[model samples]
Target: MSRDVVPTYVGTSFHVCSDRAADISRSGSRTSSLISSPSSVRTVTRRQSTSANTLLTLDPRRSRSPSRTESGDLIVRQPAKRVPLVRRTQHEAGPATPQSSAMSDAAKIQLVCTLGPASLDPDVIRKLDARGVDLFRLNLSHTGLEELAATVEFFRRHSEAPLSLDTEGAQVRCGSVVPDLVLAQGAEVELTADEVQGSADRLSLRPRSTFQALRPRSRVGIDFHGVLLRVIETGPASARAVVDRGGRIGSNKAVTIDPSPILPALTDKDVAAIAIGRRMGIDHYALSFATSGRAVRRIRELIPPGAHLISKIESRAGVQNMDGIIEASDAVLLDRGDLSREVPLEEVPYYQKAIARRANRLRKPLYVATNLLESMVLNSRPTVAEVNDVANTLLDGAHGLVLAAETAIGVDPVGAVDMVKRAIEAFERIPVGLDFTAPGAETDGALLTLR
Candidate 1:
């Protein structure tokens, strides 16, 4: 007896054609063989009256290839290898189709704002959010978990934005000094591990490792926030250095050394910060002073599965291992503040361009951080140089721009964000096809491209 067969379609119907003899045989082997043969298969697709669906079917035996219709429907030929089927549905009353790639490209430049006293108000944060602030960064070096817990709770309660916790990674700084030391140029001072009330003559540097790593002739920048010192003598527990550039050095200020000394990638404080951040449901962590893929991997083991990692490259070692670090990180940040201290200040722009190029070529997001809008920290308006700097950074293919101290402790935090937003808008206005080449730009070390 001949049998009728039906093929299933979601809210649709399919008409199958088969030989009467094959259907009447009713033998399982024959039926299977008939169904498996390409020549014996014929299908007619029918659309439901209630819905419109576009289905592209490929004929395995047909030599004539399929082509597109004027209505924008695509027809594909069968491939040598098996290809998965795709279905597209169009609804008359549904929302328009989303162009995800275009939307992503349009908003590729992210704005990261650091939250502090000035920006902690709900009104300020909402304004920033409306202006396109993508994430809020918390500096652990300045605030502990206890203090940040309230901020975290506030964000969770008031906003849908994600938070990024930045660890104070292996930073060396001056400890408590009884009297802030005044080291004049050509004067000598001792950096010791011993806990002492530091004077102009002797200053205390904790972690002892910093002292052990010092050698004669080493250049030490005491508080780039303050003075510059050069080592004249080295000791087991202390190093005697002369002030190359003189200024008053105060307590709790950062120190930088040439050929950056060996220090732990993550400090004890950093470990504690990471633990606290994990508990606070932080979505991202910025690993400060990241130098290698190994260090990033170590950090990865600590963060939760879905949390993103941003590696801040702020040292020569980090520049040297840029490829590995970028490969291992979800994103890279060019922290110009600490980085300028390590390298000559004049070399910062070059390094920024090189790093930005690498990041762009790899398609990894790069954040140009620090000093973008420094003037806005105090003034209601940013300087012309600062505006140009912001524009050029965006033109250099930076995926994001970070507002550090400008937002963290600035007098006009919202104004700073607005200024940056305007800069970004101006950058976007530049004709996409414009040539950005400058005089001697090819040799000037800036990455210039014709988009």
Candidate 2:
């Protein structure tokens, strides 16, 4: 009536030892109790294996029964049949291995999308969430105080991603225009501080001091240089400029002046917007045109506790004092659009590389904004150069990418986000081959040796 029994369950313990004969001889009568009768089941313990095929295996087929030793102890071998391998998902596989961790870190590169008329609806926000936006930016320059609360509430109602209230720092902008103003090259136009709807003959510029500060022969750029002008005459509240480059200009377009005027860090509207944001429990603020560490510290005082301060480097002064600004703020954003106005357009790439390197060295997050996918705003696809620029930005150690017009007013906001997501994933798949370090970095005791 004795039958061989083999324990199929993994990690099971047994009363019998491997050296059954010697153990029974030494124990004498104790062996009788341990073995009892052969009719009693004799369990064989299973040692755990790392192999996927053998781990957690069970087979009921008795293809090969256990064999009994001279001492009546059973010896176990392979189970009756091998269990099919069970695949595990990332979560079921337990903690991520080091190799997997390295791959996942690249996907963590943040994507910030500005919420505007095109993408501000709940359905659009949800679609953007699905497309993988880490943050939704509320550009105060475009959002009036009356609409601030409703906009913040709209985002909270639909998306779970964090909200970033972007302040309208010190930059001067044009007021409302009845229709698009078309500036013809070589035409004389009057830049006035009057808050009237703009026309081709006269454009309204905000912050009268900036208008008065314009001197004869000073160059000006509007709408990111869509139109360029040179001041011909200066007045108390207005200046006459001759259009050097002509383009159609719209409402609320940025006006950049060379020998940039000295203005306060936070404008009156910015302060009022901050109050609205605070009351709405907003904890993230992006300071535009952050000129110095002092400007960052000043706004840091107005934000809520535990709020993140992202200082934007967009002006000559901001770039000159980048080290201090990056050190003072929680994160840094490089506005290449405005920056190009201050520095030669050709030098923006160099600035991007330098800023990215410095931010990486300091262990601070750097987000690059402007023109990442400008063409995507109108077309369904991005240009090849745009895609390459995004890939290079990631290679430069940018922690995030911000899409302003692309997602804010683009025809295909979701498509734009998908493009950025693909770029990030593609970058993650690249095999890390070289270990780059600063020129003066100490080579001794380095974790990774440059090949």
Candidate 3:
């Protein structure tokens, strides 16, 4: 039997009764044994090794040398690998037939929709909620407290989905630039210290005081499509600079009048909006231009404890301090509109990926925003690029995607939200770098895209 290892084809495996032990059987040239307990398992194999002689004595070879030359002793005891217990989420604990945990995490990616003129209807709100829209963003930049409170009331009465109020942080904007002050090749645009007279329909110029903080000739940028700015010009009432390139500037739209936004977290407008948000039971507040943890802390000091804060990563400062700012807030929103203004346009995608990865790691839900379907505002559809952008970010693990002009003032608000939901679902199905089985992973993170 030990001349050489031969192919042993098993015919019938006989199982022992009441023993729960599976072992080799050899009534012929094979082997058989009964497995009992740890108490008996070592005994069975130990017992079998030496006991082989007793059985072999019965063999016709009657005392021939042991048949199993190098064959190791049988020990049918699998260290009883304690099957690890799985931790289930709340939804799993419910009656949903225990869907794949992968799908479950996908469902957890908080879907936030911005509400405005286009999406104000009760039915539309109900539809959005049904489709998994987890939160509604009220743009405090445009909607005053009264309007916001009313919107909040409508949302509460219509659905229990959460609320995120976005407060425009202190940002510089172009003062009145003669509504259509078109600059010819040689024309000069001036920001005067004096206000446009009453006939000019403008308020008097006031010093922001922080502007004094600027050193002479530092760059003061007023950015829009692409940033066209000027170096500081020293003056008595106001400063003068040329719009190296020109575009239409409206009254109070926003002027970097200076280098950085020189104000604190809670502007007078923010304070008022926060007071109203508290009264209205808003769940979260979005702080634009969130520069440091201190900015969120300042706003936190003002809002009621029930309400949380989300930092809007919109500027160079915001991106540079993303980790600290994200640490300070309950959530984060990547506002690419202002963000593009702050970073090189080519770099926004990279920023989006980095920010999403950081937020996902911290277990904080993140929102990607700005022109995500901007084209859909007028057209009923999105280009292939816009579609892929949403999917890529979803693959990147973004918790939500925000639509500003697409939803706020878009011609078809409900349609825009529907489009986003579809894009998300489509992306979720596409194969990506995600191993959904891994912990803390969902379809929204770098889905194995070709870099």
Candidate 4:
């Protein structure tokens, strides 16, 4: 061994050979000295290396024993594994304030847009999806199941949020009207109890027998909120009426008799809507004439698992059963239009506040759905009052907002969405809550709202 040779410890055992090997070509005389003691000798065979790692083999017989490991040539210990971080459905998002630079791109309001001609393009749907439209509402009341299903697919393919189907539930409506036919005040209109399954596309001055069930002094309403009419004459062939809340009764408009105290709510149309909604991959069925908890359950039974049921407070029964309905439903829709007719128009604001406050207290996500952006239907701009109404509804802690004709068949669907988006930004800028998820913790709604 060279006098300069020194010993080193790799780990705690097996000493390396330092006495130079014999027989190759040296003139030096060296004595045989096993660097590895037989009692604690261990061996590590180096195999072929590959990739970014190397394979090492240690036969147990030659593996490091406790005795050898105390002074081993190589310390073979497992490397500490690194855990990959996975993110949840949560986002570190703040309020969507236009003025605040801290806004998170993921923060969004679950805006539900009704599908119609106004916004049908695939590209437009994609844009709306990216713009934070969280859900799509397919008004099954008017569209066929096939078309509705297709539209639902379109919506789903475009965005995976969810779809809401408005049931055709037994909402009364005026007979379909002819284009430009105006029902002036004091004008007589006829309806028939026996409605032909045939679609009524063109309006006729001729009276139909559908009004036979109506009695003298019977009050009928069109569009639910547009016009309130009274029966002047009733017969098998024709009925007559005068307009009170006189807007022109138009095509496919609803005709509702002032619900008697005895009339049961939610017609067969609503049941059909519920069935179709269940058939589709819809996430929610907005109960049209949800009068009570029973009414909501009536529809919920027919829906799929994880599907949400929303009771709409638009009728006297809904108002009377408000607490029960809210408790039964996953959410509730405060419809201003039907509320105007079912309850006195002047009382709507009061009820709106009452319902909103109660819904907020209960923690169920509440949505204010109606003609919020009505001005967008005509001009590209929305009225200031309309904007303020959106802001106020947000301030009241509504979880979602809806658009109707303004987005359904209006001229500028994108602009209407933009208008709504801008309104949301303005409303969120005026923060009222530290956290918006009031009802449930870690719920999808809560997570979305917090985002």
Worst 10 residues of 4 by lDDT: 79-88
**What would the per-residue lDDT of candidate 4 be over residues 176-213, giving only the tens digit for each residue?**
45565555665555555444321222222212323445
TM-score of 4: 0.65
TM-score, model 3 to reference: 0.65
Model 1 stretches with alpha carbons more than 4 Å out: 1-104, 154-158, 176-182, 192-206, 232-239, 248-251, 435-451
Candidate 1's TM-score:
0.68
**Which structure is stronger by TM-score: 2 or 4?**
2
Question: TM-scores of the models, in the given order?
Answer: 0.68, 0.72, 0.65, 0.65
Top lDDT hit: 2
Q: Candidate 1 — what's its lDDT?
A: 0.66
State residue 412's C-alpha deviation in candidate 1, in Å: 0.2
Winner on lDDT between 2 and 3 is 2
The lDDT per prediction is 0.66, 0.71, 0.56, 0.56
Taking all chains together, the TM-score of candidate 2 against the true structure is 0.72
RMSD of each: 21.3, 24.4, 21.7, 29.0
Task: For candidate 1, write residues 1-451 as lDDT tens digits.
Answer: 0011111122332212212112222322122222333432334343432311122233444321222333434322111111111111111111111231323233346789998878888888888877768778888766655677777788666567777888777667776676656788998888888878788888887567887788888888876555888998898888899988898777656688764678887877778777877777676888888888888888888877757788998876787777788888878899988887776566576567557756655556788898998987888988899988886676455768899889888998889988888778766543232112434534652222322
In the range 1-451, model 2's lDDT, one tens digit per residue, is: 0122211222234433212222223334122222223433355555553431121223445333323333566542211110111211211221122343433223367788999998988788999887767778999888988888988887888877778899989788988886756888999989898988888888899877796578999988888647999999998999999999998888998888886898888988888888888887777789999988899888988877667778999887787777788888878999999887776665576567657756655656788999999999999999999998997777656778999999889998888999998988876544232222323224531122211
Of candidates 3 and 1, the better by TM-score: 1
Residue 132 error for model 2, in Å?
A: 3.3
